[model samples]
Target: MPLHRLLYTSEARLSDNASGADLMVESIVAHSQANNEKRGLTGALLYVRGTFIQALEGPLDALENTFERICHDFRHARLTLVDMSPASERMFERWSMTYLAQNDEPARLLVNRDLEELYFTVSTNAAEAMRQMRGLLLGEGKKPALEVV
Candidate 1:
């Protein structure tokens, strides 16, 4: 089956408290893992500064269905589809749905820029989004010097 990757960003509607955010992330991870596994999908979700940046890869139909459900989810707002295209391979193949919290170094690095700037970057540059996501998953430990476009 042909594979595709869909990347997106959304403003989180849940409380920003650490505990509340943790709970929400945990719930999302659990639910995503179960559903994605069943559908042969893989992805990663990063929550930072009241926003979520995520990338999911799977069959085109499955990715579209999953994205539709996300669009209707009440837990977030301002859903923006960043990039969607055919992918040669899955970038997050090992994870059904990996979760990264705000405090993580990579997540912190990604949100260091203003929210608007970050969204603009992702929306305009798919390569940069892939770079950031790969860096985070690979535990690069250093913040990428992403140029604001």
Candidate 2:
């Protein structure tokens, strides 16, 4: 079956506190992993400077339902669907939901480069940007340590 990918960026409504952010990340990962695994979905989620950039891949109905839940999620605000299209294959096949807490220079640089253009304009290079974002999240040769609830 053909895969579908949904990439979105959203402003986080929670306060930026060390413990709070950590707890929120844990909660999100735990919840997402359970749901995505059950639905046979896969994705990566990145949180940086009170912003969330996520890419989810799966069947069309599952992806759409997941996006709908995200749209109504209280933790997110100003949620923008950055890109949605048919994907030839899954970019994150191993992870049900990988959570990356952006704290490094490379992630910062990539986010700076892409988020502005992605959030403001309808760029034809959105797919490339999404690919780059996925790379930045998963490229460091180290998988993010997602806490199991």
Candidate 3:
């Protein structure tokens, strides 16, 4: 199976309550972790301002099947595929699903940027999207100079 990577953005259809939204994201990450582990898939998820930006990398077949399920998931609306292409190696090889939430330090770094603008940037530039996602994961504990435009 060849390695492949996919990037996408979507509107989160969760409740207005912050706690409720948190629970929903938690559930998503937990479920994704289990499924992706079994399927030999790895990815990172970024949730901010009711929008989700994710990157999935693994076997092309696994990626396709997983994305099919995501396409039908009710929690996501207006899902826009940003990029899909062959990958030499997995960008998120360590995690089945690395969840970066709104309150997370990485997310806080990006909070100053407008959600729509960030979405547009990622949608147009896959390299930028991967750099930002990887930066978010790498910047968990220490400060990494990450600028998202």
Candidate 4:
């Protein structure tokens, strides 16, 4: 089915500490994947330590309903909707969202290039930058997390 894409980027001041990143990621990524799986929504989530930018593409009704939940989702310190756009295809096939840190300028630059050239959603980019920003703010990320299966 064709999808209507909704893009949003919102930021709120997080505790000036390091432990908050995990809870932030889990708030949207975990629940989003579970919730959307049954509804056939496809999207990805990028939550920078202190900020969140999410991209959701699906049937308008489903997207709208989910967006409402996202808006009210308490994980973010602050939330704002950035855009609403159309997509020819979904970027992520599975109904899930992933979390990653924005470590360098490379990710932001990549997002800009894709936003201009590829018909893809940028909400994730918004989160990417936030992740990098948060990493910078807390002064960590010299290593990687042991992914738990």
- Segments of candidate 2 deviating more than 4 angstroms: 104-124, 140-149
Clashing pairs in 1: none
lDDT of 4 by residue, 4-82 (tens): 7776766744445556755655555677778887677866554443455666777888898988886776655457776
- The best candidate by lDDT is 3
Once superposed on the true structure, which residue ranges of model 1 sit more than 4 Å away at CA? 104-120, 140-149
Q: Report the lDDT of model 2 for residue 110.
A: 50
The candidate scoring highest on TM-score is 3
Better of 3 and 4 by lDDT: 3
Candidate ranking (lDDT, best to worst): 3, 1, 2, 4
What ranges in model 3 sit over 4 Å off? 104-120, 140-149
The residue pairs that clash in candidate 2, if any, are none
Model 3 quality (TM-score) = 0.84
Report the Cα RMSD per candidate. 5.4, 4.6, 4.3, 8.6
Query: By summed lDDT, which 10 consecutive residues of candidate 3 come out lowest?
Result: 140-149
Q: Tens digits of per-residue lDDT for model 2 on 39-121?
A: 98998887655778788999999999999999999999999888899999888887899876545466355544444544343
In model 3, the number of clashes is 0
Evaluation by lDDT, superior candidate among 2 and 3: 3
